[model samples]
Target: MPYATAPDTTRIAYQVRGQGTPLVLLSGQANDHHWWDTVRDDFHPARRTVTLDYRGTGMSDKPDRPYSTEGFAEDVIAVLDDLGIGRADVYGTSMGGRVAQWVAVRHPHRVRRLVLGCTSPGGPHGVERDPAVSTALSDADPAAARRTLLDLMYTPAWQARQPGLLGRSTVLGDPAMPAHARRRHRLASARHDAWEALGHVTAPTLVLHGTDDRFNPTANAPLLAGRIPGARLHLIPDARHAYFEEFRTVASPLVLDFLGAP
Candidate 1:
């Protein structure tokens, strides 16, 4: 229930677990700290994991205004500063990656290492999500929405083989991120343009993506790695946007290794 106040005075609720070098986690669009519920424990006892609710989601304040990726980046800094964490390794997925990109570029001193997963630098050069995937994200029926996400996120073969996985996994639904917030997040993400600014990032970076990702194509991975000096790229075959969820055995180890966590 700890809260960090952003410059705009928005309170960001966060939680810290385990014991080791701080590892700040930023979730995707419309997602809150709960997004990390499943994989978070894997990093415990080796790396301290910090998860937070983005503004307009979870326990944070929801302002009726436009949002920017830069503002989200500042939110992360506020959390770190409030915790007295000088620097921490950061892992940002999907939209979170966009925010993290800004964090690395604008506040290089606050991040030691960066992990951008299933994300892009944005702007005209970035690939767009499949129409079906976009429709699913905006679907009204809860069950239908979940189905759409499962289909777009996990490979079909994997879905058929492990039908129970979705039920057993941590809930991905966010009732707190209402229609207004979702639209605000989407609007902010649409304006994200870190393509040219990536060069300013000094943190060692790792870009992870799945070849079968329907939400964000794998081609963007190399684009990010190429732009950020010394960044490494890793691609998982047959894995989709939720590769970290379905292929945790493979993805977790890769992340742990990259972060040098035991």
Candidate 2:
């Protein structure tokens, strides 16, 4: 229920849990602060985790205008400033990863380390999602949207074996995203081009992806690690776009180690 006021006068809802060095968690496009619930617990014990609703999502103010990664990045800084956190580690997934790039590049002194999961630099060099996957993401029906996304998020075997886990992802079902907001986020994601600016990031970085990511192509992982000096790339086998969720047991430890958690 906590909120931070952005410089533009928009209210951003955020949550702080556990206690340690700040670790901000940024969710993917169209998802709210709740989307990080799947992996939230893993970081909470060893880190003071912060999660927020992007401008057009969750409890945050939903402006009907266009959105940009840079704007999203500012929202993050606003939340951190409100919390009195001068610097923090960041973990960004999918579209959130693009925004994190801006945060590290534009606000270099504010990031201690960075983690980009299932995301890309997002430019001419990035690989686009499959046409079928893109169509599913644009579906209006909430149930249909969940089904399509779950299929792309996890592999067939994993889904079959983890039926209960699927229900966890459906917690935020009512009043699904409107068409306009969805398109705005999509456009914002598409217009992100940080390939040229990535080298400016001085924070130690970790790039993660699943071998079978259906949304952002897996190849984007290497491109990110290669471009950022000293960045390491880790690929999860038999996982998809939601690799962090599907392989949290493995992913969590890797992230904690990178963050120097005990």
Candidate 3:
């Protein structure tokens, strides 16, 4: 477990693997680096991969306050500084994509390339969950929250294939998550609005979304692709929010091609 002390003195845990150009992987809401294991090998064989557990998510120290996107962004910069990495490509999904967007706008020189998956620019057009789902997420029982998340995360087919994965994921999430962290995560998410910042990003960008994504629709792909100069959009059909898991064979190759581009 490699740990870096953030400016706020919070210890962030991360893992580095492979070799070549550094590529940082940021997980989605409530998820850790394990979410990338499904597609890690697909990145260029020569590229180095860095995956970290956000402050409250995995092996990292969870603080009670300052869980804002700005705070998380600072944590990312702290990691780069600690590692002595001048710049690196970034791949972010869902909430992590929002962080990546912030990184590009705030520290443009540090990003070589950017990949946003199953995410949006966060504005009026951004996707929003049903009120019921949202309410369930804030419930006292972590299991209920987990079920609601699972419902929004994957399509019916995925649920059928992996019956107990959601329960297990929820159990793992409950112990690692603190109420304060969850509240902060929600606040950071609700307050996020990146539409105005898109034009500030100069890195080569790629947006990937699934046609059947209920949580964040495929329309978001174009919204993002259109906002970032030279950004390209790829839409996977018959896929849902968890497109990477449901369609890894297709998703991985597309990602590999995009990131491997010269």
Candidate 4:
């Protein structure tokens, strides 16, 4: 129920859980903090997890104005400032990775470590998803077309064992937003251009991706890792866009170790 005020006077909603070293989690486009509900506990008991709703989603203020990854990063800083967290480990996936890029670039002092999953350093350097994937992203109704998304996100075997998780796992849905809010979120993400500024990230960074990710593709991960000094890239073999959820058994411990958590 806590809120942090952004420079534009927007209030970002955030939540904290567990009781150890702080870790801020950024969700993908159009998703709120709940996007991490399933995977969050994996880092807990030894690490505190902070989750927030971007301006256009969940309980945050949805303004009738433009949204940029830079602005979203400011919202994140606002939350950190409100909580008096000087610096913390940051983990972002999908569009959240774009915002995290700015967080590291613009507020380098605020991030002690960074993890980018299934994301890209935008502009001309980043690879685009295939036309079919773009079509699926644009045309599908996330609410009614659950199976289509489930097929796009998780492997058939994983989906079978983790039945009905598509409702909670996918990043494209935000039931609380109006049409314009969703459009703003998409536009901000599509326009993200961090390619030129990634080298400025001072924090130790990890770039992760799923080899079979049709949505963002695996190629982008290397680009990010290569561009950021001292960054490392790790690909989850045979995993897809939702690998953070599907491959948590393989990915979570890796993250914990990278952050030096217990």
Q: lDDT of all predictions, in order shown?
A: 0.87, 0.88, 0.80, 0.89
Question: Residue by residue across 1-262, what tens digits does model 2's lDDT show?
Answer: 9899998899999999999999999888888888787679898778999989888887888889989999999999999999999999999998889999999999999999999999999889888888988888669886787788788888788788876755677323214667687779889999999999999999999999999998789999999999998898999987798888878899999999999932
Where does candidate 3 stray beyond 4 Å?
136-142, 169-174
Q: Comparing 1 and 3 by lDDT, which wins?
A: 1
Q: For model 2, what is the alpha-carbon lDDT of residue 199?
A: 94
Across 1-262, the per-residue lDDT of candidate 1 in tens digits comes to 8999999899989889999999998898888887788788889888999888888899988887889999999999999989999999999998899999999999999888999999998998788887877887778887787777777777778778886966654435566577888789889988999999999999999999999888787888999999999999999988988888778898888998999932
The residue-level lDDT of candidate 3 at 204 comes to 94
Q: What's the best-to-worst order under lDDT?
A: 4, 2, 1, 3
Question: Can you write out model 3's per-residue Cα lDDT over 14-107, one digit (the tens) per residue?
Answer: 8888888899987777666777776777665668888888888778888887576667777888888878999999988888888899988899
Poorest lDDT segment (10 consecutive residues) of candidate 4: 163-172
Number of residue pairs clashing in candidate 4, backbone atoms closer than 3 angstroms, sequence gap of 3 or more or interchain: 0
Per candidate, the number of residue pairs that clash is 0, 0, 0, 0
TM-score of 4: 0.95
Cα deviation in Å at residue 200, candidate 4?
A: 0.8
For residues 1-262, write the lDDT of model 4, one tens digit per residue. Answer: 9999999899999999998889999999888998787789999997899999999899999998999999999999999999999988999999999999999999988889999999999899999888876776556576545556667678889878875676656454677788899899999999999999998999999999999998888999999999999998999999998888889999999899999932
Which lDDT value does model 4 have at 66?
A: 99
Q: What is the Cα-based lDDT of residue 116 in candidate 2?
A: 94
Q: What is the Cα-based lDDT of residue 157 in candidate 4?
A: 90
lDDT winner between candidates 1 and 2? 2
| Deviation from truth (RMSD, Å), model 1 | 2.0
